[model samples]
Target: MERRKVDVAVIGTGTAGMVAYKAARKHTDNLVVIEGERYGTTCARVGCMPSKLLIAAAEVAHQVAGADMFGIHAEHVSIDGKAVMARVRRERDRFVGGVLETVDGFPAEHRLQGMARFIDDHRLMVDEKLEVEAGRIVIATGSRPNVPDFLQVAGDRLLVNDSVFELENLPDSVAVFGPGIIGLELGQALSRLGVRVRMFGVSGNLGGIRDDAIRQYALETFNQEFPLDPSAQVNRVERTDKGVRVTFTDKPKGKSPSEVSEDFDYLLAATGRRANVDHLDIQNTGIELDERGTPIFDHYTLRCSKDHIFIAGDANKDVPLLHEATDEGRIAGDNAGRYPDIRSGMRRAPLSVVFTDPQIAVMGLTLDQVKERCKGYYGVGEVSFEDQGRSRVIGKNRGLLKVYGERGSGLFLGAEMFGPAAEHIGHLLAWAAQKHMTVTEMLDMPFYHPMIEEGVRTALRDLNYKLNIDPQMIDRALECGPGA
Candidate 1:
């Protein structure tokens, strides 16, 4: 076996691992990145980028199909699944090609194409061939779809998030088994593609956001937008002559509870995701992982027990979003080069988005989280998408945006939006919350007129109304000065 040494060895070339590798490279020329697969991580090839592109294509197809509603008559609107897959593949190659090219530019000895396992606290055995000793190590191996034991994926009857995109043909019917981000986004996209999609999950609807009002609005929107069977816990899935049959247990009374099954061409299991830590052999290292198998680290500095072995991304378990993973990767890279200090304590508020029609974007504390933690320190205000002019112009008058704040201090706790442009607006709220901006400051800020931003203005007005202040105080405060 070949033995090598480097200053930093980054395992996994996914989003988090790539960011850490790039940052660490600036600090030391002797850095090696080990990748288990041929391509980049999930964000680049599977999860975020390709999924969004697929959803965008579906959105356009749906709009063209509905063009008749706007007096634009069309005989027929059809989608070529092969073409869609081609575009998905082409775009994925274009995006990941750049990363691969960059990796090739690094020194020959700095990139390893193999699985890395821990040999000791400071050394790793790669593909049972090369032995690498590093001063610092970063675990950027992302996550994979969590498949329950009751369900078995046989051939192509069932699939997870990663394998679903490579589907050869669109299914006539699909029974989605979870309501997480992957489930909701893919379910909505497939439904728009004319698939008879039924979703089953433990929650009344999709979970994660904190505010009940927003959650309710999202659930209602999903129910209306797609044919979702909420609160359906699938007991098992089995292959049948016709196709696949999913059995449901504990259904509501009067409903068929005895092995009610649906025959579908395909089944998607998006229940949850588990950290990819099983192969790392952490026992060989002094590193400790959390209950969920995520590497345990100091929340402030993102440092694991051995200080030099840092973790980020989904592996850290603090925040799992791609952007959060990248941010944490940068912080970890910076801190790994130096001793931990108070400066590294600065943390940013994490933001997440669920891509459904009238997509959901949430940041900071949900109303329930605030109520549980601060006990009556929170206030909430909501406004409908119908109140926004842009929503009217776009013909999507469903969904709502709700803002939460402290009762006395009026500091922005967080905001949730279930409307057009919610993902974009959620980033603004995340920035404000991270900076501890007051509601007054956010309201006083000027937003363009006749846009989805009007929803933000209206939501702030509602919050001011709850505060017993004039709804027009926003306009008045804007007139005071930019600082208002």
Candidate 2:
């Protein structure tokens, strides 16, 4: 067997792994990155970029269909399934190609092509062909879609996000399971593309929104577009001669609910994901693991058990977003490269966004987190888009925004918003939270008229009053004018 030694070794070449490799390279010349499969990020290959491309197409179709609300008419707005999938695949390949180029540019000696398994804390065996001993190690193997075994009844008709983009043409009908971010985004997009979609979730959750009012509003709004059961009692999922058959009990709001049977061309599983550490045989490393079998690591430093081993990105399953993965990778790589002289990396404020029609976003602390951390000293401010001038003007008068602040200090704690332009608004609030700005201070920022941002100002004003930092708002005085 071939034997090799390096200062640092990184497993996986996805976003986190790639970033970790680069970060470690800055500290030492002896570094290697291992890949067992194709070299591309989950975002570029199956997670973010491709999914957004599909959603973009769906958004165009939806806007054209709803143009009549603006006194404009569009004729024969047809979506070609083959053409849609073709563009998605074609553009997706372009993104993946860029990642391949980056990986190719890495020094040949620093790239390994075999699967890596732990032999010990500082040792790894690659496909039983090579043995590697390193001073430090970083694990960024990322994650894969977690499909329940019961869904196997669909057999060949089942699909995950990885395979969904590979379809030649969109299916006529699909039964989507899980109402979290993935399920909600894909289900809504497919529905807009003229596919018969029925989404189901075991728990009454919508887009992972923590605020009750926003979750309820989102549930009602999405149900208007297609059938969705947040809490479904599925009896059986079986394969049919043509495709798949699902038996369930759906409880519709304000109606007699009973058993229902449905058939679809495919069963799309948007259920959560499992971190890829299971295949590494981490138990051999003597690292402490949680009940879920994941390594116990420090969030700030990304250290697993000691200074020599680290875990980052979805492998840790702390924050699964791409940006968080990138940051964690940098921290882990930097610490691994520096080893005994480890230092904590800068951790940013919490922020999450779901790119649905109305958009769902949360910044800094969530309502639950604030309640727990601040006890009974936090106040909430809210604004509804139903009558907001800009929202009414744009025909996007749906959803709500709630901002939280501390009662004593009037410091902005966090926010949960299910409303228009939330993706952008979430960023602004995140900046404020990171800077630890007060509610009155955020309200002091300029507010432009007839824009979605004005809605944010309204919520801050309400929060200011609730925190006793300002007086109550006057009736109808907040809005500028008709459709302003």
Candidate 3:
């Protein structure tokens, strides 16, 4: 077998693996990155960029449909599914091209295109053709859409994140199988794009929002966009000449859930994802694996069983967002570079956002996590978009925001919101939480008039009152700033 030695070897040239390679390059001149899939990262290829392209087309169609509400009437607002899909693929190919360019820039010998498996703690077999002997190895094999066994009957009609963007034409009707992030975003987008969409969610909360008020708002608002059943148990799928048929039953307790059948031109499975480690034969490397066959590693340092092995990205199942994957990869690379004297660093305060109208964004602690981790007193401050001036002005006043903080110290703990530009608000709360800033301190900051940020200030104000801090404290806190 062809054999080679390197200071570090990175598997899977996705975001995490690419970042790991770049990071390790700083500490060691000898490094290699291997992949057997398309070079572009998930975000650029399917998960984020292409989906957004579809969402963009959808949002335009929706806006045109809603134009009459503002006294601006629109006529003949028609869409060509083929044209819309062509633009999405065209733009998607451009993004993928950039990733390919980067991959091509790597040294010819350092880039290996083959499946890799651990032969031992210190060696790997690539494509059963070459042996890689390395001082350290980083695993960033990433993940794939979780398609269940039953859906296989649909065969070519089934669409997952990987295959959805490849559609040459938008289906006339779609039955989204999950009501989580992908389901809601694409389902709503598809419905707006003049497609009949029926969404299924096995849980009450859509878009994975845990806050009760926001979840309620999400449900009510989403219902207006598309039909949804949050309590569904998919029985099976059957192939048909036109497309496929799905059988499911409502699972709500005491409701006498009935079996329901639906036929659609396409089915999108946004169920979830599993780490791509099933083929790795990790047992040979002696790294402890979880039930999912994902390697168990230090969440902070990304180190695995041996000093030479590190796991990052979705492979570790710590944080799966693209940005977090990149950070985890950097941590893994840095640790592998340092070898036995590995260092550790904590991740940023949690930030998650789902791109939908009145988008859902969550930051820092959830109520459950707070109750379990912080035994100390905590309070929630909430506001409705109906009362917000900017939301009303924009004619989109429909959602809620809830901010949680320590009742005694008034320190900001976390926030969950379903409102316009909630993504920006989530970042603000995450930044404040990262600094351990309190309610009064957050309120001390300036809030512009007739802006969505005022909504955030309003929540902070409610929190200030809940903490029983004096109203005068705002002035005193503000006095420390310029022009006070």
Q: Give the alpha-carbon lDDT of every model.
A: 0.77, 0.90, 0.84
Q: Determine which window of 10 residues in candidate 2 has minimal summed lDDT.
A: 475-484
Residues 315-343, model 3: lDDT tens digits: 77777899899899999988777787788
Residue 440 of model 2: what lDDT?
79
- Candidate 1 per-residue lDDT, tens place, 240-297, comes to 8767887776444488666576778888888888888888999898887677666778
**Per-prediction TM-score:** 0.90, 0.96, 0.94
Q: Candidate 3: what lDDT? A: 0.84
For candidate 2, the TM-score is 0.96
Top-lDDT structure, candidate number: 2
Model 1 ranges off by over 4 Å: 205-207, 249-259, 339-346, 468-484
Total clashing pairs for each candidate: 0, 0, 0
Alpha carbon deviation, residue 348, candidate 2 (Å): 0.8
The residue pairs found clashing in candidate 1 are none
185 Cα displacement, candidate 2 (Å): 0.7
Q: How many Å off is the CA of 364 in candidate 3? A: 1.1
Model 2 score (lDDT): 0.90
Q: What does candidate 1 score in Cα RMSD to the true structure?
A: 4.2
User: If both were scored by lDDT, which would come out higher, candidate 1 or candidate 3?
Assistant: 3
* Candidate 3, residue 416: lDDT: 90
What is the C-alpha lDDT profile of model 2 across 269-310, one tens digit per residue? 999899999999898988999999999999989998856899
